[model samples]
Target: MIPYEEIKVPVAGGELAAVRWPAGDPDAPVVVALHGITANALSWGPVARLLAGRVTLVAPDLRGRAGSSGLPGPYGIAAHADDIAALTEALGLDRVVLAGHSMGAFVAVVAAVRHPERFGPLLLVDGGIGFPAPTHLSPDELMTAVIGPAMDRLSMTFADRAAYRAFWQAHPAFAGAWSDEVDAYIQRDLTGGEPAMHSTCRIEAVRTDGIGLFDEEVLSAVRKLPVEATLLWAARGLMDEEQGLYDEKRLAAADLDGTRLEPVAVRDVNHYTVLTGDRGGREIADRLVAYARA
Candidate 1:
């Protein structure tokens, strides 16, 4: 695994705990990565390792999750977008290849729209395109249906770090794709002592952000992006189901206009493995390196 360092980034409410993988060269291209709603910076570990010093990667634990869980929120996609903008400024990054996975893809869209000058090419993994909100279901039900186990874990406690690892080990998506990088990512989300440990993700934050996924601003934010974006979608669902998040029919329905946003299908991976597995991580890292170099 490539070496990385932990750092703190000043954002709106408080400092955002982050991880940085240096590229050694001062002039190396930089990629600012964003994790999913209930995920932390360590989720990018696999991709970082695959990059192999090609580009510097900075991934942050957005407010209300993991190391930044203590930070107050006003949490949602838009709020996270603002914090991302702040992160670039704090680090003196005038332009960066902005990449996001899952919910982070939503945040990337809003951030690019809000601060176009700060971003270059956008790499959206397994998310960013908007899904039609169901009207029959209430907000809570909708969240449970969409977020599934990720949201459910927020309210559950584990006996220890080992227990937390076991929970993720059993997830269908991670069954055959588990690795040391995946384990580290899982362990980073744990908080509190043994017998009472739980995910650092805040329920309120997940609820608000899950709701924001369907917001008009978020749904339409992609249309307003200043730069081109490449969306990498998994072939399987979150639970390793046959149908993944974005298929040709779904992408066609979204009406991307085939100009600014390009959707590419990644086979044999799920939402989680698309960032954690070797195949998916290599694909994503290659694109990031190419874009950053461009």
Candidate 2:
């Protein structure tokens, strides 16, 4: 397995942890990958492995997931975008190819617009476009509507890592795509030991960010996006159904500045496996490498 360097970035509440995977070339370009709302930096492991020795890839734990979960509130897409901006600034990167999966993709768009000078091109995976909100719903209702199963899993506790694996093993998304990397992602998310093996993602963090997922802030950012961005969405929905997250017709209808946004549909896989499975992960890694080189 490829290794990574852990870093702590100072933000408003506390420190945000980041992981840097060396791409084996001193002159290689830098690429920063962001995880989904409930995922951590390790969510990019499969992608990192595929791109090893190609470019220096970095993944931040964001504000409230895994190693950085303990950081205080003031969480949201805008806050997370600022954290990314602060992180890139602290690392002294004038510009980086920013790639974000799921909610992270939304964060990338906001960051790109807010700090255009910090990024070159954007690689969005399974997110950033479909702000499909059922009108006038509460935050809880919004979370249930947008990310039901994923949102529900946050509060559920498992007996052990084995059980946790079993829960996901039965998930339709990983039907035939489960791998050691996925096991690592699952294991890393488990905290509180055996008796109370709970997800490390903070509940409050999820609540705060869940509300932002359907907010106009992200949509506004996408509308005003100034740089080139490409979205790669899966063929299946979050529950591994035939329908996917971003509807083609809906996305096509949205007034996403054509000059700034491009959407690519990825065949096979669902929300979870899009970046954690072998084929989808490599596809994303390849795109990220291409983005870095361009």
Candidate 3:
């Protein structure tokens, strides 16, 4: 049986929603799985099922994402890291296996470094240490090029759940990778409003948090984490040219001596789907369990 429980965790000066799945025994080692931007705890459903019998899985909706609400400003990597630390402390957990996808990966890396005493290992799925592209274009041009339909999504409203689902179905990001798990994820992230399903994530949070993100200071700090660490990245091109996180050369330069690097060559999987796709989920979860055991 899949042990599922909802938990309210206080962190970073606010309370967040978290789900902990005790895999067979509560005494098993815990793995904290964090989702990427625009995703919530449900993103880990597929992976969680695969590891359900081995490790206790703790998945939390980061502040301002999904059920975790009422957060103040300064919603950057540091803030998210603090939230993780607070959640672990509030739950009385230690020696955890830290894992994250995409933006969530960066958050986990920062948190593990900031609170090295609390975790034993780190597994980064498709992100961490650095991201690609800085986007030298103007803000308007950058938004149009990168965010695409999301710009319209920010202003437009969905008449019903169906409409919202349809919008997601047509989105380029999905690229025919949609599944029941992905569908459920979109549903939970949108709210029914007068004429549309609106996203709960604050637009300002994206603009402010993504701005001025990444630097040598951040990379240096992450390299100092006191635990086993591994990075599982998709071979497909995902990081933009400006982010500096996806470059094979740069990633090689990030070598911290003994950090394991695994390139997931699974078919048709890209940066986004590495953590969101079904096949990728199983692969990531299995690797995470192995990392946790180490």
TM-score of each: 0.98, 0.95, 0.85
lDDT tens readout by residue for model 1, 71-91? 998999999999998888888
How many residue pairs clash in all the candidates, one count each? 0, 0, 13
| lDDT, each prediction | 0.91, 0.86, 0.71
RMSD of 3: 3.5
RMSD, each candidate, Å? 0.9, 1.4, 3.5
Position 155, candidate 1: lDDT: 85
Error of 3 at 117 (Å): 0.6
Report the C-alpha lDDT of model 2 over 1-294, residue by residue, as the tens digit: 478899898888788898888878888999999999888888899999999679998899988888888888888998999999989988888778999999999999999998999888899999887555777887788888877888888889899889999998998888888888788777777899777789989988888887887678787777777788888889888888988887677676776655588888888778888899877888898888888887
lDDT of 1: 0.91
> Comparing candidate 2 with candidate 3, which one achieves the higher TM-score?
2
If ranked by lDDT, best first, what sequence of candidates would result? Answer: 1, 2, 3
Give candidate 2 regions above 4 Å deviation: 257-259
Task: State the weakest 10-residue window (summed lDDT) of model 3.
Answer: 237-246
- Model 3 TM-score (2 dp): 0.85
